[model samples]
Target: MKFQDLNTAEERIQLMEKLSETFLSRAGKNDEEGLFPFENIKELKESGYTSLTVPKRYGGKEISLSEFLCLQEKIAEGDGSTALSIGWHMGIIKSLGEKNNWEESVFKDLCEEVKKGALMNNCATEPQTGSPTRGGKPVTSARKEEGFWIINGRKSFTTMAPVLDYFNVSAVIEDSGEIGNFLIPRNSQGLEIDETWDSIAMRGTGSHDLFLKNVRVKEEALVELFQPGKKGAAGWLLHIPACYLGIAQAAQTYAINFAKDYSPNSISGAIIDLPNVQQKIGEMELELMRTRHFLYSVAKKWDEANDETRSMMQPELGAVKLAVTNAALTVVDLAMRVAGARSLSAKNPLQRYYRDVRAGLHNPPMDDMTIQALAKSAIK
Candidate 1:
């Protein structure tokens, strides 16, 4: 079936499985040495996976959220970092088309880039400013001048900075006295990539810091989606769950294999034969199943939803993101417990999975803040 024909969940899963086989080969190396997965990205471009969400008007297949999640998990099961890195790009692409903005020309240009397998990443998060959690600290300023606007400030965690063909940066718009997003090309003179992503987890994501000083972009590039705060920026929040779901899937697969092969000296034959180990597997399976279901349900609802419906699903998505990410972390921890000390070995996948999965706690809208928002919504 054609990519667009994959409306059913099963078909999407099958396609993702097929994609999973190829995504991991080069990604493993990249994850180990903190190297950028340029080759893996090239494969994605050639495979026509990069434009999975570009609208049909731009000559691309627009997939449902469930399908997108399935694809993200498959790629991530192969390499969590790469899947996450790409998910950010896909989220931005899909989100731009999620609503009917007056910025068709900009979408047209972005779609054109998608056609060429070019990548665009969200440039949010910053030093000193922290997250947009309490609605504060947007030090990055945009000043309107002549026919263009110049942005000045630092943006950290700018994933895909290495080969990002374009960028959608959020800054304080000088003219409007409001926060807005602008499309900036990667090579736009004053933009610089700082390799400051040395971390315990998701290091391969290439999430570096972007330092912009007087970087000028065309006025038309400024695209404001409903006043940042009130516009309901929850769409981008899905990237977190998409990634963790993949990481959890990875842990599940690895644990099953290790269970089948590992033979404790005391156990009768294999680790899987033991009741306790079997129970652990069962628990992991349940968590994986429930998380997957929640993620898919949220995505499907988003796909079939109207703008208002989608906007209201923020609480649901945030819950899924929080639950799934935390589940992945737990699943990885269980896998380590089942595997014993072997899970910590350099050759084992659990260590990397553990570190990579923990990144969700720090990624976007934050778990604590999200729950509080839900609580406040409930109180009101």
Candidate 2:
């Protein structure tokens, strides 16, 4: 099941499909217990999926943006939580390879680790400051002391904290009053996970609190310095929409199956034959069709764009995320309507899909912010 061994896109997709089928079987138990899907992640790593995004120079596949989103959507169809938790790592690796913003030696080292199945995610959200996307400077503080940086503060929404090998943390530099992203190893001294994540949705993400008490690292740990919310266009963030789209697809499938099999005494045939159910199913399919075009078209453009062209696509990127995610929510809602009361049952997968789809609304590039940006873009 090595990704490198697959010669064609169909072959790669078949591998993910096989893997996702297994993930779907375990998804219910993991969601019920709010447990991290460690076994699912292990299978992905063992299948060589974890290293797919590392650059070819680093002995990895470095799949295109469109392909990456396609695979992410497949994973989400099985389990949104697992897809999201792994998407961060995949997208970050792809972005790092494309931008090469980090020092060459440092990025090379991280790529090597990624090739070895290491996982990482950015830790920027905080309880006091909120999402970094809103231009909130991190309350976490980093100080230069004797040629080393001392970091101290707690970060919220540290997703995949239990299994991440590295955390790219954002902190305000004490000496310069500037923000910096520090790449800290999981085993670093004075670093710990607080296990505080208790969200009703996306429970399998394991987005616990990260505590750094006098954590020290060499100066090279300072990876990038930038102002919050002003970073350049990130096409990688499309993974967010891809995840929700997959959940919507799963809900649609479940509703259709339920309709086809459940026949009421009043009806001569299955409920799927009823005009109302057919209308709802039609609407769901339309939403999926529209969103898929929006998502993949934008992804295709990003994959074909040069650095200069891509730099000016922030508005388009945000629009794709906003449009696709909202459409996904609509698709899921329509599916639930088709399923009726049974969709609400705890035993039904639609219930989990409903909650997980809602979580996408709260992901990065919030709906309000995206609308505001779009307004400004139109005016300009």
Candidate 3:
């Protein structure tokens, strides 16, 4: 279905389900070859999936937070890597529109490109400082040169690096000593992508190293400035949990089907009839249902909230990431138990799901940090 044809959330979700069929079939091959899902990305762009989050003012769909999360999970079920790789762009685009953090004309122009299938993502994490969420300044620095800013630094784990049309790179301004995000076009001189990603999970994400050796851009490229240690509720980040939940769901589905089909001579019926197997299945379902409830409820709240109400939800937002991710890990573990040793087979997807779901533990809002935040919130 075309983007213009999607007048409602249901239509957009149906389109994602249709695209997921192809992604599901190609997922294992992409992981085996350690190759990027270029075709999957191409299909997303062609089908106008990339434009779904753009603001309606920019001639895009302007989907709500709940709708975005729901569609994102569907995509993840097909391939975790593809879902995650695209989620950054989806979330950032939506956040930028809602926050209006960039120059109006510049952002509007970029939104126009997004309508035409362009993609972008923030490059904040560095090898030295780790995630920008941890509150360390970027080693990447930008210097003012005449009428332009010259950026020089290497950014690691740049998801969607292969297809990104524009990069919002965070760097410390050389003169002012302020951190700012600079928008660099993909074709900028001295900008290169080094194929350095070799993670065991999310292999198809093409999360390579981004190198900038004196990359230059117009001064207007400074999109947003950072206020150190300051943060607010970010509904868009719900995409991370959405992606992992999809992986867990995939693992659960596989285990259920396997249990129903693997009939043994020791038992007259399928393993699903066994109480132990049924127990695991029931546990997986309970965790998944709980995660969906927490995730969708928070997303729906964000959609209905005003700016002030939304800003106060940072604690809840972090909690959702923390709760949903941990729940997803448990769900995947239960799924593996149901499938037995076969789940560990190299060809089996359960092992892949296990590894991928664990990555969420390392994602932003780490468990320790989330616990601390909750503690501080309680004290206040």
For model 2, residues 266-323, the per-residue Cα lDDT tens digits are 9898999999999999999999999999999999999999999999888889998988
Off by over 4 Å in 2: none
* Candidate 2 similarity to native, TM-score: 0.99
- For residue 283, give model 2's deviation from the true position in Å: 0.1
lDDT of each: 0.80, 0.93, 0.90
Q: How far is candidate 1 from the true structure (C-alpha RMSD, Å)?
A: 2.2
lDDT of 1 by residue, 269-305 (tens): 8888888888888999999999888888777778778
Can you tell me which runs of candidate 3 are displaced by over 4 Å?
Answer: none
Give me the overall lDDT of model 1.
0.80
TM-score of 3: 0.98
Q: How many backbone clashes does candidate 3 have?
A: 0
Q: Candidate 3 vs. truth: CA RMSD?
A: 0.9
TM-score for each candidate, following the candidate numbering = 0.93, 0.99, 0.98
Cα lDDT tens digits for candidate 3, 325-370: 9998999899999999999998998888888888888778788888
Give the 10-residue window scoring lowest on summed lDDT in candidate 2: 1-10
